[model samples]
Target chain A: MSASLPYAVHETAGHDNASMTTVGFWIYLMSDCLIFAVLFATFGVLVHSTAGGPDGKGLFELPFVLGETMLLLVSSFTFGAGMLSAQAGRKKQLLAWLAVTFVLGLAFIAMELHEFSTLIHEGAGPSKSAFLSSFFTLVGTHGLHVTCGLAWLIVMAHQVVRFGLDGIALRRLACLSLFWHFLDLIWICVFTFVYLREFL
Target chain B: MKAPLPHSGMEHAESHAHGNLKSYVVGFVLSLVLTIASFGTVMTDLVPHASRLATIVILCVVQLFVQLVYFLHMGTAKSQRQNTAIFACTSLLIVIVVAGSLWVMHNANVNMMPMSMSIQSALKHP
Candidate 1:
């Protein structure tokens, strides 16, 4: 059976270039999910302990968090559209969608950082309370990821412009797609268990 | 090596993408509205105090599933089976670690305070 194989099979056997980048990025996302899982676990364990300090009910602002959630959700959709545009080989549309995603992500981070600063200024710093510490750590870690994602988006935008729809650019875009979607996944958990859990 | 020809179903996939975008926008809007409604429930104290927390938690969980399915497309693709499995396992582990630890530690806190208070009194009078 091995001896009777077609030559075309042999020729193309070693050239399976089906984008490995997507697979690699998926693996990265799994690992990142694990990281978020660990943080979520930590927050869950400590959220109610509060060490005689203020609790989630006293500190959370549902309206502001709703705005932040909306911003990130919109950004994730725009990023998805950007990926679709790239797959359709529409470079200009892809760039425009990416720019929208980048701006929205930046806005999210800005609002988050402002919230953190205002909380600290009002004597709700992490050091003052266990609840505040876990709250900030969980939310701050996400904000940091968004900041990094925005930076990555800027770099990828330049690459897309400089190299149009080349394979490398496509790979980068695929990786960004995974990262952006992964962030959205984690935020859903955060919003549900951490922020909304307060109202419960 | 030459690039492979564009798949024969490229146009179909493009149309599918457009449809997916429309669905995603609709989902986003619904989630936003649900989130706002949940906040309103909390702010207005519409529900009885005892059940208010449970109601908000249930709403949040429902909204979370909505976002995951409509926005993230979790478990939607054959190729993503492994990814879905990993996520499910990690989530289970998280639940165990977090909820388990909270229960244990809270019980410990309740049980140990009396012992500590007795010891403090003994020491003070001695």
Candidate 2:
């Protein structure tokens, strides 16, 4: 139910058809969604395959992960605020919001990296069991997306500074909004089926 | 209720999408409430293990819809009928990819086990 994105830089010079960029980006997000779906399926199938290793229950810290979740949730809200400021043509406010969002996003990634490192340190690394393997694949992949998103946020903020909120900036902003919020959506599943399920 | 979902109209629908502050507040608050409730459901001894899983799953789905409406502006995007339809198809594929793989792999795991044990024992165990 979407179309067009900001004109791509590589499109033939005259073929700067800006109309399809957003929709095309939507399709790209859906395809990424499918990739997550497969990883999630792998996790579900092998969730019990711990092979005598430490499973999720003993490995996860609920409060710490909750802190991480809240960070991402608030970052999402901040990004939404950035989008609103952009919509109202308040470029400075938008940039401020983006800065808040970038820090929060960075914090979330830091916590995730910390979590992964701690696990690896304890000899509970991905190679420890099938469960760990699937766990790392699914959660690491999400972490990877957040990293790319933060990079995009940086580039977009720079573009906004240089170009103002021109057609290209607005289009890119809209896509980044989707990308950021979409990560939050995926995290809901991760927290539910991955983290919270340890208690289950 | 139906029409030739024009492309420009679709772009305008998506481009102008982001719902305002009130919606964002509602989505944010509702999401936190749902998330806390999910954690509480597991940590507190209030619910039995059997029902705990189901309860959290339900809460997760509800929170998802809450975010979709308030955060992603799905309500606004409804005007983009084709996009919505494509989204529906994508959701279907997600269900199949996840559920379908689990089902196939599970049965295969059971059936493909070594046959050294008695058939009755194997069947009972699997």
Candidate 3:
């Protein structure tokens, strides 16, 4: 059965190539998801093991986190707009939307860094307790992914400017859109499991 | 200066793009509503404490599917079935690992030796 196959299917090759890239990116996302799952499990296990330190109830600032969430969420939406622009072959619109998304992404990271610094200054540093340690690792990993994503966005924006809406640029933008949306998905889980669950 | 993308090849892509943009808009609005709902449920004292956890859990799951279908285009005919299959398998593995760890660790904490008991015995022996 394996030997009888023909491999000369160039008619559908473009679609196949696009789907192949998407599938590969999906696998990457799944692996990233498992890493987060491990981190979340660690947080669940140690959330109560505060080691005589402050817990989530004492440390989390809901309003600040809500602001951060809004920023990231809007950025995801903007990135989707950019993808739509790319598909429609609107180069200028694509660049404009991408620039907006990048700004929102930067703002989100700035807020996150400010929050982290405040927590550390207030003696709730990761090393101070098991709860904080798991908290930092899980949230920090997500922050790192966002940082990388910001960099990717800049590179892709540059490519779109140089290449217009070529096949390669469209494919790359689609993959990045998936990555950006995946980050939003992960953040939803983080806020639900890590932040909101604290109040519960 | 450069010629526009081929009309024939992109006809399908163009139509799909318009439909996809609508989904993105719908997804964005739905996600915002869901976020507000979760936040309101958690912050307000509307629901009893006992059921609050379950409420948020259900909300999270619902929001997850919303984003998956609308934003990620997970179930659309345009998306590849193989991608969906891989995602389903990945989700199963994640559930097993996360739930398994929490279950085992929770049981361990319940059955473990008391820190006070361990400390006192160590001091006495020394």
Top TM-score hit: 3
Better of 2 and 3 by TM-score: 3
lDDT of 3 at B101: 96
Isolated chain B TM-score per model? 0.71, 0.74, 0.75
lDDT of 3 by residue, B71-112 (tens): 787763444456678889989998999999999998887788
Query: What's the C-alpha lDDT at position B42 in model 3?
Result: 84
Which parts of model 1 have CA positions greater than 4 angstroms off?
A1-20, B1-19, B114-126
Worst 10 residues of 2 chain A by lDDT: A1-10
User: Over the stretch A134-177, how does candidate 3's per-residue lDDT look in tens digits?
Assistant: 99999999999999999999999888777566777776788888
Q: In model 3, which regions exceed 4 Å deviation?
A: A1-15, B1-19, B76-78, B115-126
TM score of chain A per candidate: 0.89, 0.91, 0.92
Which pairs of residues clash in candidate 1, taking residues 3 or more apart in a chain or in different chains?
A200-B53
lDDT digits (tens) for residues A7-108 of candidate 2: 323333222334356567778888999999999999999998887799999999999988999999999999999988887678999999999999999999
Q: Mind giving the per-residue lDDT tens digits that candidate 1 earns over A40-137? A: 77787678656556777777788888888888878888887887788667889999999999999998998998988988887888997677888888
Order by lDDT, highest first:
2, 3, 1
lDDT of 1: 0.71
